[model samples]
Target chain A: MKVLVTVKEVAEADDDFAIEGTDIAESDLEYDLNEWDDYAVEAAVQLAEAGIADEVVTVTVGRERTEETIRMALAKGADRAVRVWDEALDGAFADVASKVDLFEAVVAEEEPDLVLGGVQAADTGFGATGVALAERIGFEHAAVVNDLDVDADAGVAHVHRELEGGVEELTEVDLPAVLTVQTGLNEPRYASLRGIRQAQRKEIAAKDLSDLGLTADDVESSLTITSMYEPESESDAEMIEGDAGESADRLAEVLREKGVSA
Target chain B: MSVLVAAEHRRGALRDVSYEAITAGRELADARGADLHVAVIGGDVDGFAEDLNRDGVDAIHTVADGEEFDHNAYQAALSQLADGIDAGAVVLPNSVNGLDYAPALAEALGVPIVTDAVGMAYDDGLTVTREMYGSKVETTVDVAGDRFVLTVRGGEWPPAEGVGDAAIESVDVDVPESGARVTGFEEVGGGDVDIADADVLVSVGRGIEEEENIELIEDLADALGATLSASRPIVDNGWLPKNRQVGQSGKVVTPDVYIAVGISGAVQHVAGMKGSDTIVAINTDPNAPIFDIADYGIVGDLFDVVPELIDEFA
Candidate 1:
């Protein structure tokens, strides 16, 4: 079985993000693969390690920094990588529809048994790429997947979906499916010294829309953007004081004073 | 111009969030001088559609079919309807199911898409408000296009009201090729009330120490008739389930009363609950940021103060 995993680079969670004019402060912001996507890559590696799947290919759409994200996946265990390397993607997916067409082209060529992705990226957090690619390529898809186990012998994959109300449901589907892994799906493993060295020798494929036989206009935007701005500032932080017991009393009194509670 | 809003339902029942999306759409439509158009999917959603036929909506588009519930099929149908009606903008609830198809639908229709939108507007183009960087910052994005798709966050905008008869338009959508089949759906049931809808939420953080100590927080929740929630670390440690997690990576909630106990108010956790109507934080550290947005705060060790607070509320 062959697998395709979509990865992305996002500003690290610890980084301080600020919007300056129309653009974000990309300077001083350390970029890494989206944390949740780590689970997707790990799930593919585990499948290969268990001999339930044969090979894994990692795909990402971005500029030079995205190569780092793909490299991290390769270091873990993905067999190869493909980068779309578009500048518009750094801003938003809405401006880069051609990426979907490119993904569709690769899916047709690879004919993979399964496509996996993180439910949402830390940046933008649109969580739309997997579904968009799946729809464009005409494949079955599931979202918020917390657990996935492939029974390659029967050509079936069983997945658990996270739902509201602490409700979880087990669903089974056939091969050639798209599964969007949610956070906590599986613990991602760090790359071993040997694996890191081996990744340097692996193939990292590059492709563009022309190679996919699709033009940028094929997936151009239908909506127009007017402007982008930051939210207005609200009140600043209000500090409370005193020992545990005294503060609790003051809290109760304040709640009563605000008529929030009595 | 008429604004189009997709009415989302589960197993043929209109979801509460869809109403909120409609409320949001109605406001945008009103501002733009556009009539609202609601499109209801699923084989038996007409009955549900009737309940949503408010005054702002000019008509309801019904695509009643068994396959219409599937993401690709539903998205294809919506895409066709968007093209057929020449919709000004499409609205959806930024729910799990809606998120599953909204972007794909937008891509299929070649429209710009925005998810978890908290605000909306119409000028020369469509602009929306969305929280980013763990809710520490907000970004207002403007999409360039004639039509766009937006998935609204739950509770970001209150549900709309005022009822009148909306005209019905039965659209015949050709079912597109489907790649997935729902062999079955099982319901994973969380505890009684979902934290998202709860009026009061009592959440725990790492300072609780042991699992057994959870009972104290539970007691407080019981006293206030509030729901129980936790930070990601508490959930990650298995002290609470993922459903109860409150953080940027967890569920975003806008409850009426959110009480944080032993929580340091990490930015990630605060992003999920900061929209609450009233916040009360109880932590040993007086400097915890949770006190910033909190209407009331107690700088106390939860172990000593929780019991007394529970007794007072009880």
Candidate 2:
């Protein structure tokens, strides 16, 4: 079985940042492997380690700057990676459909038996790409899966979908499936020195829209980001102003006034 | 054109987000001069339909199906209804189940989708307001077409009240054979303590940095005679057990005092504890969303402040 995982390099705002246009200033944004995708990478790598999956491939829809982040996935045991980018993709926020268009093309070529991805990208938080991809590519899908057990013989993936309020629904999804993994499914491993050295020599197949037989028109996004701004703070909290000890003193007083005691 | 809002339910009861979606749907329907149609699929559909018949709802459609949410069934039923009603805007709850099917439903209908919407505006076209970068910034997205799908966040709007006499209809649709089957459900986060029972909750989050440092928080909780709880990451890291987790998927807590330590209030975490009577936030970043809902705040390092807090209580 060949397993494919969708990875993204998500952006995090600094302690204080500036907004430029419809996004945070690039200089103010720090990029890293999305925390959720790290778990997905680990899940796919484990399948390969267990010999159930012959290849563990990671696919990312990001710009050239995102290669550094994808390399981390390779170091953590993804066999290889495919980075999808194009000059056309730089415009308008790539909606869920646009991402599905790109991944659908890769799914056509790779034809992996299983696809794993994070429940949602931390930056976009749309949480829809994985399911949409499954729909477009005609694959089975389970979302917010917290536990997974794959049976290649039965062609079934037994998963526990994490629901709100501490409930998990156990489901069996047929093979050729997409599972959007949640955090804590497994502890993601750090890249070792040997793996880092090997990652530099490993292949990262870079493909553009044309390579995937897609054009700017095929991936044209109907969504436009009109404005960006910091949400106005509704806080009316009484800020305890002081150094640590001084603030603690006031906090103790406040806690006492609230009748808190041992 | 009509605005369709799909109501959500789990086990036996309709979720609050379903009512919230109704309120949001009404807003959109009013804006477009369109009728608001509410849909409830599976699990006591008739009961769900009655509860969903709130003011401004012009019609209600219920599909009698399985007991719980099956994305395939939801996708089929909603698509058929949307097509039948000629819906221009479909509003859905951006819950866990919502995420499971909304994208596919949009794809099936060949429409654009935006999830977790906090605000919306309809003028010449539809624009949605959503948070990004862990709620550090908000962005307004413009959809170029007249028809679209939206999954709305819970608690963003008031629940629809003052029941209406909506015309109820039973929609017959074919639920196709699915590749996924939900066999059973298991309740997690059940162990020693229930944080929901606590009056004062000392919750820790990512800022604690390491597992060993959780001791400091335990010490503080011990000193205050309070129960110790945590945000989702702490539980996700196995530093704290699920029972001690205070978040959407863990437990909803409304303690008298929710002392958030080293936690930047992510939306999910906030959903569980924002109802606390006296919310206190202690973090280095004053701009953290935790402070926005905090009743009292101390902008300082948890390392410096938490130990001192322990000493004061001791």
Question: Which one wins on lDDT?
Answer: 2
Quote model 2's iRMS: 0.7
TM-score of 1: 0.79
Q: Write the residue-wise lDDT of candidate 1 on A113-167 in tens digits.
A: 8999898877667777787777677677788788798988887788877655344
Poorest 10 consecutive residues by lDDT, candidate 2 chain B? B45-54
Q: Which candidate is the best by DockQ?
A: 2
DockQ of each: 0.35, 0.89
Model 2 clash pairs are none
Off by over 4 Å in 1: A13-18, A86-96, A206-230, A233-238, A241-262, B31-33, B169-177, B189-202, B205-229, B232-239, B242-278, B282-293, B297-314
* Local distance difference test values of all predictions, in order: 0.74, 0.94
Docking class of 2: high
Q: After aligning candidate 2 to the native by TM-score, how far in Å is the CA of A195 from where it should be?
A: 0.7
For candidate 1, give the lDDT of residue B224: 69
TM-score of each: 0.79, 0.99
